[model samples]
Target chain A: MATTMITTLDRSSRAAARGLSDISIRNLFIIPTILFLIVFNIFPLIYSLGYSFTDFRASTSAAANFVGLQNYRDLLSDPYVWSNFAITAKYVIISVAGQLLVGFGVAMLLNRDIPLKGLLTTLLLLPMMLSMAVVGLFWKLLYDPSFGIINYALGLGTFEWLSNPKMALYAVALTDIWMWSPFVMLLSLAGLSAVPKHLYEAAAIDRAGPFYTFFRITLPLVAPILMIAVIFRTMEAFKTFDLAYILTSQPTAELISIRLYKMAFQEWQTGRSCALAYIVLIMVLAITNIYVKYLNKVKER
Target chain B: MRKTMTSLLAGIGLVLACGTSVYAQEKELTIFWAEWDPANYLQELGNEYEKETGVKITVETTPWPDFQTKAFTEFNAHGDAYDMVVGDSQWLGAGSTGGHYVDLTDFFNKHKVGEVMAPATVKYYAEYPGGSSKYWAIPLEGDAVGWSYRKDWFEDPKEKEAFKAKYGYDLDVPKDWKALRDIAEFFHRPDQKKYGIAIYTDNSYDAMAMGFENALFSFGGELGDYKTYKVDGFINSDKAIAALDAYKELYKFTPPGWAKSFFVEDNQAITENLAAMSMNYFAFFPSLINEASNPNAKNTGFFANPPGPNGDQFAALGGQGISIVSYSQKQEEATKFLEWFIKDETQKKWAALGGYTCSAAVLKSPEFQNATPYNKAFYETMFKVKDFWAVPEYAELLQQLNQRIYPYMIGGEGTAKETLDALAADWNATFKKYGRGQ
Candidate 1:
C-alpha cells in the first residue's frame, strides 16, 4: 500500500528527488581515494616532475644549482645512455616476443588432455613466484665461471657469464625467460580453454585439417586474450630492474631502468633521471595504447 | 565538489604538518660506517659523544663491498641520510668527486689532529692528492698485510737440521718471495696433516687481487703513475711478471680447496695448526690472543712482510677515514664529536676494544702498546706499512686489474707476460683518462 502511494506521486516530485541525488555530496565516495592518491602518489610525482626541469645534483652543493634543460641536453648526447636504452628495448622486445611464442606454444600443448596436468601447471609456475632478486642472484652463482654448477655440468671450460661484457646481458635475459615464460603460458592456456568446442566441431565437419582449423577458428577467438598477455608482459619487461642489476655487471648490458636508477641514485642527477623515467613511462604507455587498440579492432571484427 | 576540496585541503594540511616537524629540528646528522667489527665499538663511543654534547648522532653502516655503493648513492642523490661517513682510504678519490665530504685540513690543523698523526702515516695515508693540504677524512683504522708463523715448527731442532740440509739455511720463516715458497714446499707433509702455506682465494678474483697487489708492491712495481698515463714502466715490468711467477710456484705447495680461501680462512688454517705460515692483515693478531675464537690456534706469532731482492718489504696499508658531510646542518656539533674522537684517552679506549690502530698517539702510548697480548706484534707490524693507490679511478683500475690479470696470474689461466701486458695496456688507457700519464 505504501509503494503504490509513492508510485501515485506526480512526475515533478520524482524529478526533484533524482536531481537531489545527483548533486548529493554523499555520492562522493571516490573523493577519499582521489585525495589519497594525490597525497601519496601524485604529489611526489609532481615534485619529481619539477625536478626534471633543473640540474639538481644531490651530492655537491656547487653542482646542486639549477641549470635548465642542461641535464636533458647532456642525457640526449650521452652515448652510454642511448646504448642502455637500446639494450632495454632489445630486452623488452625480445623477451615479450619470446614469451608470447613460447607461452602460446605451451598453452597449446597444455590445452590438450594430459596426465598430471594440474601438478605440471603448479610446478611450472614455481619460477614466476620466486623473488626476482633471488632469481637473479641464483643465476649469478650458477653462472660463476669457476665454481658454478652450470660450468661443472656443461664442461664448458670457464665461460665468464656475468663478468664478460659479451655474455652478461643475455645471461640476465635467460634468467628472465626462465622465470616469466610460465606466466604467459598460463594466460594463453586460459584463453585457449575458453574457446567454444562447437567452433572446432564445425571445422571438423567441414573437413578442415588441424592447422587450418587453428588459424581460422582458434586464433581469432584467442587473439584478444593473447593481446592482453602481450600488453601485461611488455609493460613488465620495460620496468625490469632487479634481475639485470643484480645478475649482471653494470654499464655492460645496462638497461634503461638500471640507468635511471644509477643516474638518479648513483650519479645523483635526480632531475635528469626523472626525465628519463618519464620518457620510459611515456613509451610504455604509448605501446600499451596501440596494443589495446589493436585488440579492440580484432574484437570489433 | 565540496568533499574533493576538503580532502585536498587535508593533504595540504598533512604536508604542512610534516614540513613544520622538519623545520622544528635545528640540525640533523647521520654517520655512515662499514660493517667491520669496530663499527660497534664506534657506536658505543657515539654514546659518550652524545652525553658530552647535546646533539643526537645516528650511525648507518654497510658491508665493505656495498659501503661505497651506498655512500655514493646517498651522495649522488644529495640525500642527507648521513652527516658523516667512514670511508676506505682507496675510495677518497671517488668520494672526493661526489663532493659531500668537507675539507678538514684547516680544521684538522687548527685542532692539532694533523700534527698528532704519525709522521710515516701522514706522509702516505692521510695526505690528499695534489698537495692541496686539504684532508677529506681523518684516519680511523690502519691495516697492513704481514706474515704469521708457527714458531714451534721452526724451533724443533731436528726440523731445523733438516731445513739446513735441504736449503743451506736455518729453518726459519722465509724473508723473501722465493724463500717463502721454498719453505712452504719443504714443510708440505700431506701424510702428516700439514701444508707448507695457505693463501685464501674464496672470492677468487678479490682474494687474488689482494695477494697480487701485495706481490706487485713488494717487487717495487706500481699499478700506475697517479699524475700521468705512462703506466708501462712498472705494470708489465720484469719485476711484476717475476712476482706473478712466484705466486704460481707458491700455489703448488697449497692444500686442496686452496682456491676457496681468504684472509680469515688462511688465518684460521694457521691458527688451527693446518698450515705452517699465513699472510694476512695485521688486524687478525688480536683474534689469536683469544683461545675462545680459536681453540687449536695457540702461541701465534707475527713478522713483517718478506722483503724482495731490493731488501725493501712492502704491504698494502688498508685503512678507513672519517669525514663530515658538507650538507649536514650540525657541522659544529659533528666536528666537536670528531675533536673528542681524536683525543688520546678516546683513541686508547677504541684501540683497546680490539679496533684497528688508527691514531698514532694511541699506537705510541706505552699503556696501549703493552696492554694486550698481541699489541706489541701489531705495533711492530705498523712500522713496515705502505698504502695502496688512492686515486678516484682506483675502483675502475682495480676492476680492470682484477678481472683481466688476476685470473691469469693466480688461476694459471694465462702466462705471466700475457697477463702483465694486458694489465699494462689497460692501465695506460685508464691513466690517460685520469690525466695521470705522459
Candidate 2:
C-alpha cells in the first residue's frame, strides 16, 4: 500500500514538472530579482576581490591602482591589525562562552514548573529585545565611573570599565553577554518544551533520577537544537560591534567588525577592509560548516 | 452617484497639485555637521537666517566618527546629502581635491573673512595650499590647548611656603614644563590625602598622539613635514625624548591607574578637585570660572602650555572648521548662510554663546572678551595655539605614533627613548605612505 502511494506521488510530481516547464512568463518573474542580486551583492564581492589586489582607497578614486598582494603583505606585518584581531578573538570567545553557559543554566531554571515562570521568562528576555545602540548607550552610562549604578553597587571604587585597556574588552563582552544570553535561553527553552513527557515517565518508572534522565535522554535529544543555537549565537557574537564601539571610550575594545569599519570608513582603506571582512566571512563559514557537520552527526545518532 | 465620485476625484487631484506647488516654493537646504558647540548654535541661528532669507535650513548632526566617512561616501556616490559640512582643518586637503569643497578665496576676499579675522585664524583656515587663492573652509571655531590649575591650592600661604621649602621656587602658576613638573611632583603624595596632577595616558591613537603633539610641540618638535607625513629625528629627537621622559616623571605624581585617564577622567579630576593641573583645551576652563559648579570659581587660573627652553609655549588646535560640500544642491543658499555666519557680528555671537571659543576673530573681539572675565584669558591663549599633523592621513599617522609612545610614557613596557626612537623610525614609513617627502 505504501509503495503504491509513493508511485502515485512520483507520477504527480513528474506531471507537475512538465506543466511548469511550459510556463515561461511565470519563471521569468524571478529574473529581475536574480539580476538585482547579481548587480548589488555578487558584483561588489567580485569588485572588492579585484580591488584587494590594488591600492584602492575609498576617498580618492584616482589613487587606486594595481599592486598585487601588497596590502595583504602589509597586513601581515601590521602590528596594529594583528593586535586588533587578537582583541577581536578575545571578545568573541569570552562573550560566546559566557552567553551559552549562562543561557543554558537560566533556560534549565526557567523550564522547571515554578511560580511566575511566564513573567520571569518575559522579564529575562528584556535585554534581548532592546536595540543594540540603546543597549550600548545604557551600558555606557551604567559603566560610568562616577554616576553609574554598576560602580555604585559594586562599591569597588568605580573602575574605568571601558576606558582602561585591560578591562575594556571584558566590559564590552559583559554587556554583549547580558544582551544576548536571553536569546540563547529562549532557543533552549523551545527545545526543552518540545521534549516528550513519555521519556521522563519511562525513566521515572525504571527508578531513574532526574539527573540520570537528563543526561541519558534529555541531553542527547536536545543536543541537535542546542548545537544549532550555539552555532547561530557564535556567528552573531563574532560580528558584534555596536556595543563595543559605543560603550567603550576608545578602540581598545574594538571587535573585528569595528576594526573593519574603522579601516573602511575612518582610514578609507576600502579594499583592505573588504579583504579583512572577507577573511572574517571565511572564518565564520568554516565555523558554520564544522557546526553543521557535528549537528548532522548528532541527528544521525 | 457617478457625478459625486467624479467631483471627489477632481478635488483630490487639485489638493495634490497644490501640495506640489507649495513644496516647490519652500526651498529646503540640508546641512551635515559633526557634533560641535557652534554647529548646535548654528542650528538655532539657522531659523533666524531662514526667517530673514525665507530659505529653510535643515541641520543634521553627525557623530564625529561617522561624519567624514558618511560625507565622503555620499559625495562619491553623487548623493545630495548635505549643503555644507563642519570639517576639521586637516581634512581641507582631502576636501579640496576634485573641488570636494567650494573654493572660497574669491568669496572670502569679497567678504573680507581673511582681513576681518585674527592672523592665527586666517593662517589656519583662510589660507589654503596657495596663499593666493581658492581657500576651502571658513574657521567656525578655534581651539587652543592649555594648562588649567587650582588657584586655591597654588595660592594658599601654608602650601606655598611648604612648596618653596621643598622646591626652592615660589608657588606661583607654572610658566614652563620645568615648573609644571616641580608643581606636579610636589602635589604628588600617594600617602597624603591629595594628588598633584592628572595626565591622560590611554594607549588609543588620538589621546596619545594629541597629548604627545601638545607636549612635543611645546618642546619644539614637529609631528611631520609640511605637505606629507615623515617620521624623522624630530619625532624622537633629544627634545622629543626629553618631553616623553618628562611625561613619565610627571606620571609619577599622578594618581594610581594614571595610564587609563582620558578627557573624561581629566574633567572629573578638575571638576571634583582631585588633581591640581590638567592638560586640556581652553574651552574647558569656562566651567571652572562659572560659579554654579565651582564655589572657588575665581580661584581657577589658565596658563599657556609651559614653554620649552626657547621660552615659546605652544598647543594643539582642534577646532572644527566649516566648509560647503561640493555636492550640495543648494550652494547659493549655503554660501549666503556661511557668509553671514562668519561675519564679525555672527562670530562674536558664537564666542559669547559660551560652549565654544571661536578660533581667533570672535575670541579676539573686545566685545567677546568683555562678555566674561575668563573669556579674555582664553582669547589671549588662542594666539599661541598650533595644530598637529595638518596632513590628510593625520588620523592614521597619529594612531601609529600613539600605539608606540603611550606605553613608554606611562611606564607600561619600555624606556621612553626606545619607544620614541621606534616611533620615529615607523613614522618615516608613514610619511612616505602619505607622499610626504622626508
Candidate 3:
C-alpha cells in the first residue's frame, strides 16, 4: 500500500510540472509578436502623440518644449491647411467614384462566358500590381506635352495636360483610376460570381424584365461588397502623394499628405506634422466608421 | 575525436581574432553626396584615396530630393555614419549654426584655402551668413546657370534672313531680355514640331527657384534686407512685378508644358531637337558635349543670362560645398582626405574625370577654357552669380515662394503683384517665428 501511494504521488507531481510547462510555452509563443508591435508601432504612435503638443524640429538637437495645444490651434486656424484638406476630399470623391463605375462595369462584362476570360482578367489586373512610383513616372511621360502618345492619339494640338492648373487634378485622378480600378474589379468579380444562379432562374420564370430583376435581386446582394471596396479605396485615395507630386507641381492639386511631407521634411516642422497626421487619421477613422455602419445596415437588410 | 574537434575550433577562433585586429587597425571613412554624375567621380576619387592611404573610404549617395532630409536626420540623431558631406550651399547657415558641421575657419587659415578657391565661392558658399568670418565648408563645385542655343539654327542663312526680316533685327546671340523674347517668338513653330526655349517653372525641385531668381534680381528686386530680414518692400517692388510679368509672357513661346519642365525634361528637349535654346547648370555642359548624335552639340553656342531691362545681368549660383560632419569620429582622417582633395594635382585630375572643381588655378588654366564649347561661358557666368537666402529658415522662405510665386507664374493663379505680396507676408511670418524679424 505504501509503495503504491508513493508511485501515485510521483505521478501527480509530474502532471503538475507538465501543466506549468504548458503555460510557459503558451506565453513564449505570444511574447515576441507583442513585443515587436509594442516596440515599433505602439511606441512610435505614443511618442508622436506626445510630440504633437510640443514645438519640435527633427533637424536640430535642441530639446522639445511642450507648447500646450498651439500646434493644433495654428493648423486649425490656417487657411492653407484647410485648402489641402478640401483638395484631398475632392480627389477622394472623384477617384473613388470613377473606380466604382469602371470596376463594376468591367466586372459585369466579365461575368458573362467570354473566350479567354481568365487571361483577360489577369491582364486587366496588371496596373494595380505595379508600384505607385513606377506608375507615376510612366503616366508622367504619357502626359508629356511634347512627345506623349496620349495627346498624339487624341489629335490634340499642344495641350498641356499636367502643367495647366485647371486640368492637373483631373489628370492625376485619371491616373489613379487607371491603376486601382482593377483592384475593385477583382473584388467585384468574386461577388458577382458568388450570386446564386437559382435566383436568376426564378426571376426569368416570373417573366420579370432585365432591369427590374437586376434592381430587385442583383443590386441589393452586391451592395455590401461594393461598400467594402469603396471604404478601402476612399482611405487609400485620401493619402495619395506619389502620383500628384510626380505628375504635376500645381499647388491647386496639392493633397494633404504632400503638405504633411513638406511640413515634416522640407520645413522640419516635426511636431506640427505629427499633429496634422493625427488629425488626418481621426478624419479617416470617422469616415470609415460611417461606412462600416452602412455596411452593417446593408447586411441586416 | 572530441579532443581533435576542440583543437580545430581553437585554431579557427585564433584566425578570426587576428583578422579582426587587422581590420580594426585600418581607419574607415564615409562621404555622403547626392546621386548625380559628380557622385560617380567622387567614388572614383575615393577608390584612389583608398589605394594611396591604407584607410578605406566609402561613398554614399541619395537622390537630390532625399539628400537633405537624410543628411539632416543623421546629424540630428548625432549618428556617426558620415565623416564628410557634400552639402548644398543653402545648408551652410543651418549646418554651422546648428553645429551639424565642424567650424572650418581654423582649418581654412591653417591651410591657406583662400589662395586655391575662387573668392566669390568662398563668400557665397562657405561663409555662414553672406560675409561672416566663420567658415563651415570648402566650395567644391563652382556652378551657375548658363544659356545655350542651337548653333545650327543660328548659322542657317535662310532662317537667319527670315528672323531678321520678321523682327527687324539681325539673328544673333541675344544681348538682353527683349532680344531673347524676340528670338523665342521667331523660333516658336508648333505646327512644325519645334519650340523656342526650355525654362523651368516647376516647384517639384529647385528648378523654379534657380531658374527665376536671376531674372528677379536683375530687375532690381531683393529677397530681403540681409541684416534686418525685412521683405515687405523688396520682394513686392514694382521692378519685381515687371520682371515676373516678363517671365510669364515668355510662356507663349515655350513648349506646351514648359511650366512642368525641370533639368531632365529641359535636357531632353535640347538633346531631342525639340527646343531651340535651353538654360541649365554649367556643370551639365560636359554631358551635353558628350551626348551621342546630338547636332546641337556640334553647333552649340553659350551665353550668360541676358541683361535685364535695367541693364543688370546676373546668373543663379548652382553648386555646393564639402564639410566634415561635427559628430564624425574619424575627423583626423577626414581632414587628411580634404587636404589631399584640394591639392592642385588632385583638382586637375578631378576636372579630367568630369568633376567641376572650384580651384582657381584649375579654372584659370587654358585646358579648362577649352574643355567644352560652354567652358568659357561657364567661367564668365560664375563671376556674375547671385544666390538666395542661405539662412536656417531658407526652406521655410522657399516654401512660401514655391507655393505662392510659382503658381502665379505657371498656373495662372493670381497677379504677380498679389503673389509677391502674399509671399512677402509669409516671409515676414517665418522671420517672426525665428525671432529674426525687423
Candidate 1's displacement at residue A213, Å, is 6.5
Clashing pairs in 2: B142-B359, B228-B436, B229-B431
The predicted structure with the larger DockQ, 1 or 2, is 2
Give candidate 3 regions above 4 Å deviation.
Answer: A1-26, B1-25, B293-295
Give the alpha carbon lDDT tens digit for every residue of A1-301 in model 3.
7545332223366545556454455567689989999999999999999999998988766679999899999999999999999999989999999999999989989999999999999999999999999999999889887779899999876788888888889999999999999989998998899899999999999999999988898888888999999999999999998888888778879899999998988878889999999999999999999999999999999
What digit string (tens of lDDT, one per residue) describes model 2 on residues A1-301? Answer: 7545332224356545555442344346678888999999999989888888877766753667788787788876777778777888787789888988899889988888999999999999999999999998888788876567898898956476765667878988999899999988998899898899898889989999888998998788888888988898878888887777777644566677877776777767777777777778888899889999999999999
Model 3 over residues B265-338: C-alpha lDDT tens digits? Answer: 67767788877888888877666776473545776778888888988888889888899999988899999999
Ranking by lDDT: 3, 2, 1
Predicted complexes: DockQ each: 0.13, 0.27, 0.60
Point out where model 1 deviates above 4 Å: A1-126, A138-174, A202-241, A244-301, B1-29, B50-56, B63-66, B76-81, B90-99, B123-125, B145-174, B178-212, B227-309, B364-438
Q: How would you class the docking of model 1?
A: incorrect
Best by TM-score: 3
User: What are the root-mean-square deviations of the candidates from the true structure over C-alphas?
Assistant: 7.9, 5.6, 5.4
lDDT of 3 at B433: 84
Candidate number 1, chain A TM-score:
0.85
